[model samples]
Target chain A: MKVMTLNFLTCAVKNCKSSNDSFPLHPKEAELAKDDIEINPQLLINVLPRIDWAALRTTSTELGFPTLPEQPPSPEDLQSDEALLKELHELLMETQMMEGKLVCGHCGHEYAVKNGVANFLLPSHLV
Target chain B: MLPTPDTSHVPYNRVYEPAEDSFLLLDTLSSPSETAFLSSRFCSTSPSSPSPPNFGAPLVLEVGPGSGVVIAFLTAHASTIFGTPHVLTTAIDVSPFACAATNLTVRKAVSEAEAEAEAENPSTSGQWTSAIQGDLVSPLRPGSVDVLVFNPPYVPTPGLPAPPPAPLQELRDKTTFEEDSHLLELTYAGGKDGMETTDRLIDALPGVLSERGVAYILLCAQNKPEDVKGRIRSMGTGTGEGEGWKAETVGTSGKQAGWEKLQIVRVWR
Candidate 1:
């Protein structure tokens, strides 16, 4: 029963290049789940308490998190939302995806994550 | 867990006394006792490394040093154990109180060592390591160290209502969750996601590590032990793998409620 919304409001909009760190995730990179990683269950469950349920639902979508039905989750929702929850789980949890590339939501930046390692550094002008 | 000079109960962002009771709270950590082993392991690597290229003059750097005690310990034994001719230690911290404490403690350690060295060599007492503010070094020089040690703020969740006074508060992060920004103190808290500071440390290490240089990091529950391994694995130098740089859990830091089961992890690179 966690809801999150994309809060691009707080990001450093000073420039588009603030989001390209790969190895150590840059603070500004859009938080989305990749193929080889899974969302942390504890972080997801814990965030259920601290985050805005409605906002979470909205932002996860914009951030490319899987979508679920609008009907309020029930006592059995944890079981029903299993598939979507896993998707949401990956969205909220901190993960180190070694393979694939991270696409930027703000800028058209694609950072590569290979061998469980991501190269986040961009060229000087991009920086 | 401790009171600042002002005795305010409000917590987070305050510098607490370094006594065993003040900061060693085990409320969030699984087992502080196990963590004590981590701290010991974090420290033990200094003696295990093959002598560095500069055995004649060992230059050591420490970051986020609280009271200079750890450096003092390393410098004291480095010569005999690490084959260092003379150790030049530099302890870095943002807190003036901590820096002063580090200066005094290092000097005291040097004097004590000099007292011992006087039995054989007279020059031992005069060479004391330098302590400066962290800002002094911007984007720390690349590959310039024999042993680099750091014990950052590794508190899991600094839920205390109010922050501590100046100097100490400067050491902690001023960011609130609303900001979604990071603070040095929050790095200690590790938040719901651990490795808050460890991530930054990892990003910085690539530039700081010397070829074949040794690094020691002290971590608590704020960091995920596995991630520490993961990042170390990513280093790709082949130094941290296969049981070489182990993050062993150390025992309690001698506190009251929390630290009895805290795990302090040490990373060597």
Candidate 2:
């Protein structure tokens, strides 16, 4: 899964839906891969507004990347700063979690990721 | 008409094949009226302008994108269909096989479209996220989805099969015929009135969708399309827009003796 996808995912457990910590499932033992995609600056800027900057910061730190700015850069700032744009593009678009476990903070459930696909199907007991 | 994404590589034994229902979705989404609606809702600027929209890119999620044909088509032709290339696409499915197949299908379609664009014009395809294995919309964050598409298990059957255990979700080196059949059954075989699965998806709409969210769901004659639309209209989007919800039949096909065999319903706030 692309690193950006983590921002939109939460714990599958229904009860965790209302919890603040359930989202941006933490990555553990994550095997990462970087694909050399041609950066599309406009696409990155388009996606910036929708991104949960705080969650992205947590994910990037968990995945061992350098710490991101405390606040997301404004669209105009991102547009003018080529280095910042490329950094965001690399983390959001190019980095892939090839293998790992996404742990929900609320339920402490570990959703396993193998071969780039994360399995979110809970066991019958949990479901 | 846009070229259908190549799903020839998808294994039909486990994944749902692109059928008339799938084709109807392609036709409906790309239709002039639907295109106008999508573009107006998603695009912030005129197409002639080169600047990105003021709003964030609309995230398009396809629930149960079996062979990924539908999502691939939407991703590959985002500009043509939604009037903007700045769209984000993803998929969720219960079957791991389907997830793997979708990833390949979307990638192939995007690359092929990119190649064609290089020779003809600038690329207009949207960005494809990843296809994850999950049940319905259970794994998604609430109020995050902007455009949702579903081609559900609308075939009425005695009962829905039990989903495979998590341990069994990984791809095995080989599978018995019975296992393959069971996996395929998950793609169809709605438990009761063919609405068993669709109903669950409908209930999630109000909670999963963003305020500007819209959904395109396919249903057959047996599913009682009129009643379904009525129920959707009555439901609240929680946006407090005071208009409640709106459901309309935007596309239909396989008409016989004044009876519509299958139709696509567009539901929105």
TM-score of each: 0.45, 0.96
Cα misplacement distance, residue B85 of candidate 2 (Å): 1.0
lDDT of 1 at B12: 29
Q: After superposition, how far is residue A68 of candidate 2 from its true place, in Å?
A: 1.0
Q: In candidate 1, what are the lDDT values of residues B44-108, reduced to their tens digit? A: 32546734222223346667555555555555544443333244456655444455556666656
Q: Score the docking of each candidate (DockQ).
A: 0.01, 0.86
Clashes of each: 40, 0
Model 2, C-alpha of A94: deviation from truth (Å): 0.6
Question: Candidate 1 chain B: minimum summed lDDT over ten consecutive residues — where?
Answer: B1-10
**iRMSD per model?**
21.1, 0.9
List TM-score (chain A only) for every prediction: 0.40, 0.97
Highest-DockQ candidate: 2
Model 1: residues with Cα > 4 Å off, grouped in runs: A1-127, B1-16, B19-56, B123-127, B135-139, B158-188, B192-194, B238-269
> Recovered native contacts in candidate 2, as a fraction?
0.89
Best by lDDT: 2
